[model samples]
Structures are given as structure tokens and as C-alpha cells.
Target: MFHQITVAFMLLIVRALAHDSPGGQVVLTSDETTTQESTLHVVQEELKEAEIIPTVIDDFLPKFILNVEWSSSNYASLGNLLKVKRLQSEPRITLREASDSSASLCASNMTYIVTMTDPDAPSRDNPKWSEMCHFIVTGLTLSSTSEEASSKVHFTDLQAIIPYKPPGPPPKTGKHRYVLLAFAPANGTTDPLHVSKPEDRQHWGTGKEGHGVRDWAKANGLKPVAANFFYAKNKKQ
Candidate 1:
């Protein structure tokens, strides 16, 4: 009877977690996949020990629907995962020319607007420089000249909204959230969005009033499609 109950409980748990997709119909993240696999493995072990009829273990496997990764000259940060978790130590991004290298995005005919920011400078409470723009690109497509290969890795012809500038978290300030956001024209048109990069907004993006990410996206009918971010702490050097 105990064995039967134990087996029933295990089956219930496995069934509970057996959804078509993780995180409620959107997609399964890397960490989410790891957690699911770990749980499933445990359930399988429990079933084996319980002497219960073993079911197909692959029945609970999560399918990968989408994957996107962003990398720069300084640090390689995988999509959805925070930066501080990946890097050994905070890099002095200001001194180095950290341009973007490659991204494993969905192969599609789509334009993208990439924006990076530091939302922690001058401390989190009294953030004087929130969202310090690091890099911004626009008009990226599959056949774009920016990509080295006609490899269909999801980006091609592109424009730079804000040229690449490495992370510069000020000294004495707390860690900064370096966020890279990609937006697609909400209108879904292929027309070139000839937007001139704003000036004096390099640090914290306070240079131009009302011309920020939200404003520009509204004006150009842009919708955020993808994003990645990491944290960089204050480096005295």
C-alpha cells in the first residue's frame, strides 16, 4: 500500500510538471530547463526505488522554442541570465572598446533595435544615472552587411542608434544593471528608421529629455522583442 501511494504521488508530481511549455505557454529558460530535468531525474529514481512500473522518462521533457544570445568584446552574457553570474570579476568596460561580436538569434526577416543601459549608477536608491546607454543598433535584418556570414543567424543590415560604449559604473556607486534591449517596429514595416543618435546622453541617458527608449519606441511604433542584461560592480581601477 505504501509503495502504491508513493508511486501515485510521484506520478502526480511528474504530471503536474508535464506542461506543453514551461513558464506558462511562452518558453523554457535555461535555468528552468535545468530545474525541470533535475526534478524529472529525481522522480525517475523514486519510481525505480519504489518498484513501480517505469514510464517513458522523455514524457516530461521540455521543448526548446526559442534561443537568443548576446556577446561583446568584454564579456559573453547569455540571454535571460544576469551578467554578474557569468563574469569572474567586474570588467573595466570604460577603458576597453567592447563592441558586439555575435548573437544566436532566430533566423527571420526582421529589423531590430538594440539598446544597452546602466540602471544602478550613483547607487540604486538615488540613481542619478539610470540607464546609461552602452550600445544601440537599429535596422538589423538577415541579409544585413553587419553579419560576417549570410548564415541566417537573425541579423544583417543594421544601423547604430547609439554607438558601442563599454560599461562605466562610477566608483563608490553600487553595482549597475547593464541591460541590452531589442525592439521591433510595432507597425511591422521594413522601412528604414533613419533616427539620428541623441547627443550628451552617453552617461545615464539624461542628455535628451523625452527622447528616451520609451519615447522613441512610441514615436517609431517600436515594440520590445528581445533583451539581455548583466550586472557590473564598481571597479576602483
Candidate 2:
């Protein structure tokens, strides 16, 4: 498997360094350190490219699993890294149990609000414009099907308060995480929500840090139900 190979490669690198040095004290020139760093970077990128890292538990917290699939056949499973072009269109979303996709959660007969946001607006290191709202759809509901289809939801059938904005990470800004969240009506209230778009994408229009889906959901009496996310970077980068 790719993961096994990556781990083996990393071990080999470490062993090589230890073997080359005396008494386990490895000394390297400036160029050697740069080369090692580059190699390590490649390993990290390969892990992401292989969709072996960045799980929902690792990236987004206090969240459940939501199945998000785009027309391009790319799925946002466990924070898999995807190309920006592949995510240009809105993805079909389905709410599922946090631990089981086949088993449905308590989302039946509930109207949901779906939202997408970028927690790393500029870059992970510097996210001054963090939590940028990318998409928001209200009046989303489950399809008219059997119990097995309880996870299915109608995304395109409703209107978006904040239209979908494709991921366009600036060149060399590292990878940005785009998270999709589904919120159900709070306190067993199923009335269609009259939500409005944020004044701006930055910080969900709060004009400050620490403002995003959680804040918006609290203000509108929406409860977090299920969520999913993906990573995207500029092609030029």
C-alpha cells in the first residue's frame, strides 16, 4: 500500500542519516538539510494526494460525517484533498451517522441548512481572513424514498442564500480546507429557515476572527448535524 511505502521510505531516510553519522549524532550541511526537507515535503504531499490523511476528526471538530459528491466523481471523504477545478460545482450532500454511512442519523423529516466555508482563507499559517463563507443553502430536505434513502437530501432543489464560490487558493498559499456543514432546525422546529447571506465572506461578515458556521448557526437557531470537508490549492502552486 502507498501508506506502508511512505512509512518505509521515512524509516529508511532516518536510518540512512543515523548510519551516516557517528554515535547517532547526525550533522548536515545547509544544502543537505534543504534536500532532506524537500524529500519530507514530498512524502507529506504524497500522503495527502493518496487520500490517506486529514480525517474529519483531524481537521473539523465537534462534527459528524456528511457524504458530499460532485459531478466530477470526486468525493469529500475524510477530508480528501481535491483539485480546485473538480470542486467548481455544488456537490450533492447526504447526512449520515458519524460512524456509519449505511445507517441513517436522526435527520428524517427535517429541513436542513447546508453551508461551506474556508477556514484557511489566505493560508493555514496566516488565516486573517479565516472562515470565509463559500456556500449556503436553505430548505434542504430528504428525498421521498424508503428508509434506506434517509441519508439522501435534495441540495439543488433549493435556493442558496450565498451562492457557491469555487475554491481559488492564491498561488503559493499552501492548501486551503473547504468544509461543508449540514444544520438541522433547532429544538425540533422544522419550519423553513429565512436565512440571509453574510455581508461578506470574510469571517462570515463578522469582520473579526473566530466567526464562522458555529456563530451563524447559533444566531439562527440551527443545530449542527453532519459535516464534511476537502483540501484544495491553486494549480499554479
Candidate 3:
């Protein structure tokens, strides 16, 4: 009976996500004490429906909830479309445990790395430069404390190895998927870590097929913990 209810509830979530306005604001409403795991599944389904899972990374199992706030009120909500101008600046990121939202996940001592990529670089149908590395930031640390439970804790010191480049899809290229992935030291090994920049944005320096986030993460001994993404296109197109 519980399984049946979960399935039913999930259907409602899917409908809500499907209907959310493209330009609508994404607000974090729940208290810090609990990050809803059900929401996590909703995000997972969004990725699958949008083909972000197979197109970029092969699979994803989120250990914690990743919240990305683009502006004061705008947050990354699944595959919602947004104007290119609104995403020019770097967005803030926060990670919270899925099991207990109140329980903060990032520790002061731990380091995290983030990567933003565009899998549908020129166009989804013909992606010669598939999986373009939009940006990469390392040396991120937890910057907030428990006292700010009402508010989310954001990662600090965004040291971008590959500086942020805003989405600029060519006119009439159709919509592009901008994916952000968060990684931590695999197996809790917290040594000073470094990620090599791709040879070029195109094919991630591997090939036309691309080296991709999964390959890069595995090579660096980092584990993908959480992810979020959005869609954008040249408004003129």
C-alpha cells in the first residue's frame, strides 16, 4: 500500500514539474530540518525525461540535494527554459543531505568540485562539439553554519579552473541543455585534488564522441553526488 501511494504521489510531482512555468521562480520552501527526498526523485525523473542522463552522464544517484540559485530568486528547476542574459553570472550552490534536510552535508575541511557542460553544443541533432565544458570550479568549501537553518548554506570560494562562459547558442540552433554536476573525493579520501582542463570544449578532448563528465570524474577519483540542469536557446531563434 505504501508503494502504491508513493507511485501515485510521484505522478502528481511529474505533473507539477511538467506544468511549472519556464520563467517562474524556484523557491526553497521547506525548513532546513528536512530536505524532501521525494523532490529528489522528481528531479531524477526530469533528467530522464529530458535525456540528460544518457546524453551527458550515464547514470545518477544523488547522495544529497544540490540547490543552485542563479539570482536572488531564480533557481535551477529541472529542464526549465531561461533567457541567456539571466545566467551570465556564476550561480551559488548548496548541498544538503537527502535523508535529513536539517543535517548539513558539506564540512569545512572537505573540498568539492563543480562542472557545467553543454551536451548539445551546436545543436542536439548535429553535435560535432558535443559536451562543451562551459565551466569548472574547485576548492569549494562549506561556508554556512547550523544557525542559518532557515536559509540554505552555499559553497564558498568558487575557484574556476575553466572560467564560466554563459550560454550562447547560435540563432535557430534550438534548445540546449546546460548541466551542472557536483563531485567529492571518492571513498572519503580528502587530499588536495586537481582536475585537468579539457583539450578544448569540443569533444572534451577525447573525440567527436567526447570524453564527458563521467570519464573526467572517474579519472580524478571523484564521485558524482548531485546534479541539476536547465535549458536555454538563442531567443532570436
Candidate 4:
């Protein structure tokens, strides 16, 4: 039932992460305190009705490890970095500081292809299951030490088939979930377009294999090596 609680919060965090600037993780603030509180109240009521004991957001999902660091924000762990008032600017990543989390260092040769998706479209309650992918970086390499600055052994910027595009959810409609997943492509860049830089990332079509995380992982014969997410709220709402 703990997993169910996590799922419920994930449903709440439907607006989780979109994009973080290359500079680092950034935070977005919102003033919808009443709405936010009301949403939490609803979640609590649902939990009580189900006889479920809800825990803090930290227990909702597994945190991520990048170069021996755990993924986090000023507020809490992964999936806990809530609220992006505006869907544009990249959020600053807080990987370099994971002193409190149980983080594991990675092997030098390990690499992953990261992708983030927006599940509900036009708006959260609307149709268009084909989610809008917000960020896709291929060939991200992990190094033993933070000093290693080579792009090849770093976050795999050059292998970006699609550049980072901040998610801009349609006004109103409701909140949406943005999940980030990291995978090890078994085919080793099967698509011809999986180059250093694709012509575009903003206008790419939504489908299963091309940019979908689970679809891509299924097609590539691997699961997500790492995953992280956060939610955001629209200003108009």
C-alpha cells in the first residue's frame, strides 16, 4: 500500500520536472497556496478512506544518483521538488550536494540516455496520450570524480538528439506530470537521427519508440538506470 501512496502523490505531482539549465537546477515558486492546500486535503481524505497511512514526499519514490550524488532540491528528495510557476527556465540540479541521501557511486564506463515526458496533454484532464518530451540527452557518461569535466564522460550534452526545451503546458486544464528517466540503449544509437544534435527537439512528434521513456526502454532491451521527477502548477490556474 506504500507504493499506492507514492502513486497518489505522483498523481499529485503531475507537474513534476520539465527542464534544468546547463548551468544547474533552478527553482520555480507559485502563490496558489489555497489551491495547493486544498489539493493536499483531498489527497489526505482519499488516503484515510482507503485506510492508508501517507508518509512524507521523500518516501514517495527512489532518488537518483549522478556521479555519487543523490538527486534533491531545497525542499525534499526526488518527486518532492514541487511547483514550477512558469514552464520555461531550466531548474538548477542539486546533485553535487547529497550528504544526507544514501547515494551510490557509479562505475566509470556507465552511461545513460535521459528523457523527461509530459503525460497529460492539451492539459492534465484532456486527451493526447502522446506526451510531450521535454528533455532528451543521449550518451551521458559518469565519472568517478566531480573534477572530470570532459563532455564525453559527463552529462552527454553532445549526444543530445534533442536539445532541452522547457515545458509549456497549455493554460488551465489542470496540472501535469513530467517524469525523467535514464536508460542504457542496447542498440547503441539505432536511429539515424540519434546524432550529436538533431535538427530540432521542440517540434518532434510524440510516439512510443522515438522519445517515450518506457517505449524506448522496451525497444532497447533495458530499463531505466535512474529516474527522477517533480511537479509544477500553472499560473493561470
State the TM-score for model 2. 0.65
Candidate 3: give its CA RMSD in angstroms.
3.6
lDDT of 3 at 35: 39
Global lDDT for candidate 4? 0.41
Q: Write the per-residue lDDT of candidate 2 for residues 52-144, one digit (tens) a residue.
A: 224211222222335667752576643456778887777776643332332243455657778888877787778888778888987666442
Ten consecutive residues with minimal summed lDDT in candidate 3? 25-34
Off by over 4 Å in 2: 1-65, 97-108, 143-155
lDDT for position 106 in model 4: 40
Model 4, span 179-202: residue lDDT tens: 555555444433422423322332
Q: In candidate 4, what residue range of length 10 has the lowest lDDT sum?
A: 52-61
What TM-score goes with each of the models?
Answer: 0.50, 0.65, 0.82, 0.50
Candidate 2 collision pairs: none
Which candidate tops TM-score?
3
C-alpha lDDT (0 to 100) for residue 19 of candidate 1: 45
Of the candidates numbered 1 and 2, which has the greater TM-score value?
A: 2
Cα lDDT of model 1 by residue, 106-162, tens digit: 235545566665555455555555435566666554333233333233223345566
Candidate 1, lDDT over the whole model: 0.42
Ranking by lDDT: 3, 2, 1, 4
- Model 4, residue 98: displacement in angstroms? 11
**CA lDDT of every candidate:** 0.42, 0.61, 0.70, 0.41
Return the TM-score for candidate 4, rounded to 2 decimals: 0.50
